[model samples]
Target: MSRTLLAPRSWPLAVKVPLVVAALMAALGVLASWLVLANLADIQERNLRRLADVTLGTLAASLAAPVERRDIWETFDALDRLTATDSGMPAVAMVVLLPGGEVLAASDPRRFPTLRRLDEPLLRAALRAGDMLFDTSRARAVATYRLEEGGEQLGTLLAELDIGALLAERRRATVALVVSNSFLTLVMAGVGYALVRRMLGPLSRLAVAAERLERGEDPGELLEPPQGSREFRKLFGRFRAMARAVQERETILKRLAEEDRLAQLGRLASAMAHEVNNPLAGLLTVVDTLRRRGEDDGVRRHAVELLERGLLGIRNVVGAMLVAYKEDREAPGLTRRAIDDLRYLVQHEVARKRLELVWTNRLPPVLPVDGGAVRQALLNLLLNACGASPVGGKVVFEAVAEDGVCRFLIADQGPGLPADMAAILERSGPPTTPPGRGLGLWTAATLWQRIGGTIRVERVPGKGTRIRLAVPVRVRAEVV
Candidate 1:
């Protein structure tokens, strides 16, 4: 058993292509933005740290000879000059820490709550641990380095670096990205929609062709797309080729069926006509003898009755065989008669084969249908039915108007066939078993279909089989 769902694959290229492109553009946009952001942020921090390190060393250089207050002031004055030269950089505080947690000369001493206290985490770490450290807090990257003179550690240089430009730069970048992405999205939507539509338009044409085939109508030329992309041409080419192949095969089957039907008529034409002519000629002779002898009224009436019935039966046989020659190929002798009259044609043939006849012709037979075709189809079905039937079985013929079309049923007491065989007859395809190079029911079924009609079979279980044939009376002119 299959557990997965089976589905048809259709990309509807218009939708799939645009979505994939949009997703790719978004990914690339994010990736480029991330790279630029990371570099700008790192550069801001690195530049501020370099400036702090240089300023600290110069201030510490003044105290190289002796650690004194005046020396630190001299160092601080020089650091102020340096800060003026690079004024664009934010104001930074550089503090020197003593080993016992006391701060030396520092920038922005008024900003601190206590001048004697070193509260910076980096500064405290430098004083207590006497180790170099780096820490960041409140948009600042701070670092402390131990200042030494001649392999002897003097104090710790604590530096504060401001790097807020990273956020400002990223904000500007994001604005530019929004504008660029908006423009790209518009272009992708417009161009992508056209590209998808162009690629999928051929499939729409193919759908129309399929519809034509389904309604049994002639299909027009499909797209001949050598003017488009290579893949598109190849795909359309295959569709066109398949449509042509199907149409061609259908045409061949129709011709073969017509020929088979005509051929069968040719073989049976002599015997069938002879069968009707003999009874008809004998009845005519008896009527003439009755007239010449000046017989009583009852005797003349009896002979006339036989003559009328025989002539009616003969007219029906000829009517069914109107298309006996090529001259009658597209002609039909359609006339309305009592539907009960059609039943009489098969009644004799049925009784001769020891099969019961059934039908009362309940509806009016003023149907505008080709009576000849109906008679031909009915006669062929009864003959085939008799071959399958046993002695003293029932054969039924019925007529009615259902859903605005005239339908006829011809059933016989014969062995019912398999479902597959019934399907083949319905399709109008050549028999797989070929009906063995002789006259058979498929031949007649094909001929009936060519003129806007159809034959279908239904099983009657214990009784045997029923073949129902229907033709739209509105199409009578086309059939004729």
Candidate 2:
């Protein structure tokens, strides 16, 4: 359920490509800035060290003669001049000390007085640490140089150089690097986004067109040739061809469906004619018999009974056809009569195959279900069973109402249903029609599904196929 950035396809190419470019640029910028800052800091430190060395060496040379003669005023003057003349060195304080660890002269006399031992712990530690020590915490460098004449140790000169300016310069450089790199990264990221979006514009258009096509709407101007590279043009051409093919196929399928419907209607009409003609012929024969024996009460009574049965048979056939084909705002509920009507609808098929139909109806007088849909579905199933049964074979049709549901079962004495047809019945979705075959079963399955009915099929190896349809009694009527 959770997603990660590593799955780039989840993001659009326009965004993903630009984001990757921006991330890579930012990383490179950070690395470059770090390297440049490091190098800049090194250079600044080297220059500061060089300046400190020169200032210290020159100051030591100037103090050598004065310290040997113990001229405190001249030594203090030399230190003062060193600070006044050199702007780069920024010497904070200077001290002249004797070889015996006694301070001879101090640039700040009140703090480090003449002829007093040096007591600055920081300066003492820096002196003991090395000839030149940088105390970055104090933003200063301390240097100690021995003032010698002819290789004789005359005295020592100590100087503290202020390095705050160098540190500030480095800070400014860092800010500049950061600002420049950020600006460049943003510029490149924006350019990348725009370019990628422009390049993939056709793909976005194609996607929109595809969605429109899927909804069975005309894409029209959406699928028009786009202005871009050759590959996009080719893709658009292929899509147009594909769309044309799809439209053509759909048109053909619609035509085929219309034809199939007409063919089915023709067959039903033929069967109705055959069924009605037989009953009508029998009624005419009975009428002729009654006319010839008008005085015989027995013959008249028998003829009247035959006429009533024949009329009833014709009514059942017509009534079943009307129930199957008629549409109403509110559907009638299922009943025993509707179930029995199916027998009349399929009698023509049963007779054509010379198959014996075993009909059973135990449903209540009325049940809360769409009677039309149920009747039509059962008729289709019974007709299918009759067709599948061989000549002189039995086609069993059973309907029962139990436990708030209506169940209908149809079994054929022929070979078991083909695997594909059985699979269609067993499937929960709308069933697809096999080419020129199994249309009846498909129609039945579709109707059953619309009314929230379930189907179960059992086929025995030595026997035949049994299909059971169960419909909830209280299911809402659905448009079939």
Candidate 3:
């Protein structure tokens, strides 16, 4: 998870693009600063070497005659003059040695008295020819030169040059480079951020338009065409086209649903007429018998019994239909009777197919769920199963409430359900209506989803298809 969060690919383009640009600029700045500092240091070192050579050569030529004549005053005077000069090199101290390595004269006489052999490590190390050493710890450079008169070595001169000025200049350059590079990096980063934000403006607007479309609102007039690159304009065009198509499709679906509802109502009306007419015919027979044999006690008793049964049958059929079709908001909570009402509701289709139905209900007397929705969903599933079953085939339906959930199962003994139809039950959201097909299954699935239900389908080869629905039990407050 940390890797996922830190991964650059997952970063938003607004941040990622500017950060990359800033990083590249910083790297280039650092490289440029390093190169400039290195080149400056090299030039400064070269100049220092050249100055050292010139200063030492002049000092050595002047000192050679004085040391050969054993003139301490002249040697001291020459050393003093070299230190006093305002040359670029800051000479701190100088010492002249005789041919036998004895100090002839010194700029600091107390430190190196006359005729005393030079014992200082720094001065002794500089006695070799053409050797220039820089002592960074002390911020000084030491140079040595041998005094010669007509191809004869007179003595040696050692000079210690102060280099604080050169070091100070390099420090100033470093500071300037760092400040300028940092400022440049910040400016470039800000510019990069602005450009990226402007480039993504169209995408942000497109996203808003998409959100509006998702909520089933009209996006065509509300969303302006994006004005940016060709790609962004084309994308907005395609999105507008898709939104129109979606709106049209939804309009057609609503129309189709209305038609399907009317068709279902017609079928129910026909079934109810058939059921009521049969009982009415029986009532007619009973009425005729009662009128013809009014004084016969056994005939009157049988007539009354038949009248009661026929009226009761008609009432049950009407009541079941009402329960299945009642508005959900006005319907009572789910109950055993509401679940059982589905049996009567689908009886017409069952009879038409000549199928055997084995129904078992083990629910509590009442449940905290929308009874009308459950009834409607179950009615559709039962009707679908009855239609799928071959003549004389068996369809089974079972319902039970347990563990805070109510489960319903319907199985039919016929050819297995098609894969596409089975997918309607297995999908997560509302089932899409196939063109003029699978409307009943779609309605059942949609109703199930409305009540927070899940569906599972199982197909057995050479047998049939089974669908199970599981709905969680809602609380009383939630049911309302």
Candidate whose TM-score is highest: 3
lDDT score for residue 277 of model 2: 92
The lowest-lDDT stretch of 10 consecutive residues in candidate 1 is 1-10
Q: How many backbone clashes does candidate 1 have?
A: 0
Clashing pairs for predicted structure model 3, backbone only: none
lDDT of 3 by residue, 167-220 (tens): 889889999998999999999989999999899887777777778765556765
- Model 2 / residue 148 / CA error / Å: 5.3
Candidate 2, overall lDDT?
A: 0.81
lDDT of 1 by residue, 1-480 (tens): 133223313545677688677877778777877787678767766766675566666656765554434255654555456556664545467665555556655666664332387666655665565433334345555655667778877766666656455556768977887778767876887788788777678777777877886445666675555465787788777877887787786676656656766665665576466667678678878868787864688777877888788887777766545433334534444443434444444444565677777774544535656555665655567667766777898777777777867777877777785566566557764333244332456555654675577778888666788888877766554332
Q: Candidate 2: which pairs clash?
A: none
lDDT of 1 at 21: 78
Residues 317-420, candidate 2: write the lDDT tens digits.
88877766676738658778777777767778888888888988898888988887777677777767777788899998888888888888899987888888
Give the TM-scores of the predictions, in the order they appear: 0.58, 0.61, 0.71
Question: What overall lDDT, based on C-alpha atoms, would model 3 receive against the true structure?
Answer: 0.83
Query: How close to the true structure is residue 400 of candidate 3, measured as C-alpha lDDT?
Result: 96
Clashes (backbone N, CA, C under 3 Å), per candidate, total 0, 0, 0
Higher-lDDT candidate among 1 and 3? Answer: 3
